[model samples]
Target: MSPSSRTPSGATEASDTPSEADETPALATIGEFGLIERVTRDRVQPPATLLGPGDDAAVVAQPDGRAVACVDVLVEGVHFRLDWSAPEDVGRKAVAANLADVAAMGAVPTGLLVGLAAPRDTPVETLEGLATGMWTEAEVVGVGLVGGDVASSPTLVVSVTALGSLEGRAPVTRDGARPGDVVAVCGRIGWAAAGLAVLTRGFRAPGVLVDAHRVPTPPYAAGPAAAHAGATAMIDVSDGLLADLGHVAADSGVRIELRRDAFAVPDRLAEVAPALGVDPIDWMLTGGEDHALAATFPAGTTLPAGFVEVGAVVEGEGVVVDGEPYAGAPGWEHFT
Candidate 1:
């Protein structure tokens, strides 16, 4: 079930109810450290963390003596809508998207730092709930919330920076995909896109797609697994499949030929496509935000479970879907 649906009965309605008079503003600029404690208290820390939220900086145990870091930013109206997604869902997505970048580097996430900007009138309870969501999702990836900053702003803007350890494995980059490599993917694809379509069409789905849009359940462990299994190149599918693959192709100077029939698109998506006046292939090829991992492995390599072979690398440039260059929308951009 989606987190919003799972919220206790009347909790949302109660939150939505207007008060006779706005409560007195708690305290302006509660100070960063004090606010951090308020948010991170009662949260669990990861086993690999040598130190957690406190001090000037967090200390994490990096067995490989190297750390992978990535950052993501979410804007209120552009990336998410407060009316549609709860604050908690926004928090979870902010952390998950950054963590996926770490995973794409073939590393296990170790810690995260969140930066939140909300209106002065934003409810303290809502901020706390958002923190809870961040902690919850970090726990799933075996990471800890190490620190953060909060400030007043006109609109909600969440930025997350994630740190990861390679566990002695070499970091995977986009330029390593050689010709004759097999391309594979781990985790669901296009669900978030389909959900976006449903939301745009003013329709409701079976909760799976909405949940996907809220919190992408990526195969976090599969990234390091692929590296150990000798993956040559890797990336996260935050941008549509073809657009992201194009990065690998451009970097490696090779062509990617995706076998569309190999994708495991959910039946719910197919069922809703006609009703929503959307095409399933559009979701499968050009949808983004699913945070799935896509990697290229040497031919004859045995792929780990939860990953499926979806394409292959060839001697050329750009990506082809089923032996032809797919001419669809490119992908997502911050400002277009």
Candidate 2:
């Protein structure tokens, strides 16, 4: 007997032959529970997951007994463009961006709760690809796909809430920077911004920059390392470097001055700047989304590997680039 003939109605049969259109589409509307199963069905759950999907809430084992949480949302047109990024890339980027926040607080990501809103016409394959990407990226931070919700909407939107454990370490917040502290960064800067520039203007560049935008590989372990090394304050560079540093400066009641020449421009960027008729320096200084960790440490403290001293904290307010006030775009704003 043929596989289809033996399979029960509404059940998808594993066979070499393509199924007929008459086959009922998997659960219409991808109802909340159905959508959840579709996304988490094949994902690998971490051992830290005390209780996974299918309840009012998921429980994660926090070895330190305290959990740190951060949430971020990605709207269809606001955060990404389907034309420029694939569904898998969108899912990974959405999850990675939020995980970077938890890492910035010097925490080990434990699990994620995702809420997806999409039109009924959205393809099940697209949703599956997104779920695959989310798990792939979450694995990088040692987290598990615990739970989520789904609903109908006009456009695709993903909201993820990431939970992390501090491992008995105190969270490194933004208000601890002080005068006489050193400012440092771990991971690339401007790569994502430059990629955006190319995507928007049709400028040609190396694939690395484009990949940077699709999936940011943040220095996940550096946050906890910096915290252990006595970092005074820390934040992930989601906004422009100067703009993000300004937050540290304002909150910590200090001034930050970045030495632009301290960091070299990647060869790929220099190669494409002229083609785009833009300065690489502008991209480096004003660009964002590299998800690099920036922190303030004691003046004489030695920065850890993967971290470079880019600036200094002084007794004042505002952030300065190379001893001068930064005069450029102020980074991403929701309303602007």
Candidate 3:
């Protein structure tokens, strides 16, 4: 469910530990170090890792002599709800978001660091599940969880920092777009937003939609591919298509004009939107968390595989859809 639709429970910390008969143990019983051991024990680290968890800090190698880093924070009730999402799902979402940031820079992820805060009474299983999810996603890019911190808090909080290597390639930035560049996007859009809408409305029969809200499949390889194919600028669609493109526009001092016909509403979203009395196109336009990569390439440049042309960079400012400013909200904002 969306953060706006729910409230935090403000639960009290648990004091008493469960007996041996209990199948699930509370964090209070395991203690901080024990919980860490449970999550990190026997896990394999990739070759990029110089050292794994157990030290005060981790050591990772960047062959290009430059390291790319980004951090993301997800808090209970604000970013996710346990009732609506499993701990594994939450874990994967947290890691995926940060990894996508690294990917957007045309870097290959090297390692991940996590910081977790939860009530003493929280179930150890929950944290373990989260760790599993994080590891699974990290494995997709052949990276590992090198180190992290855990603490006690009244509310649950997860913070992840992902590090990457550019591998001797020029890192693509949002400020490089120019007039006459073509805009393209790779990977899915609107599915997570549609999923959030479904969950917020209190119906969860469609597993695909709800599952999408729980996890995002980012085009990690596409970032590097776009860079190698002479992409001029790029950004991940964490907030929304128009909202994120606005950043590229502001930074590059150019206008982005998108064609509505360029986007085809996924049949799944098309079928679900009418039942919910909403437009599928709206979700594609403004929904966040899809983690799709949007980029600009010079005109006449051959686009990378999986990238579909959707717009063009022009001599102007801001973004326009079908030659007009979008009437709906451009994207997500934390405070407003």
- For model 1, residues 1-336, the per-residue Cα lDDT tens digits are 001212335333222333443464221334334446678777778777787766666787878788898889999899988777887888888888998899899998988987777765566666776888888888887788877666556677888999998888889999999999999999888899888777777765658898888788888889989999999999999988888988999999999999989886679888888887777877887889999999999999999787899999999888888998786665643212
Residue 145: error of model 2 in Å? Answer: 1.2
In terms of lDDT, the best-performing candidate is 3
Better of 2 and 3 by lDDT: 3
Q: Candidate 1 at 43: error in angstroms?
A: 2.0
- Mind giving the per-residue lDDT tens digits that candidate 2 earns over 295-333? 999988878788899989999888888888866655643
Off by over 4 Å in 2: 1-30, 203-205, 330-336
lDDT of 1 at 102: 93
Clashing pairs for predicted structure model 1, backbone only: none
Worst 10 residues of 1 by lDDT: 1-10
Best by TM-score: 3
Per-residue lDDT of candidate 3, residues 68-159 (tens digit): 99999999999999999999999999999999999899899999999888888788999999999999999989999998877668889999
RMSD of each: 7.6, 6.8, 5.5
- TM-score to native of every candidate shown: 0.88, 0.89, 0.92
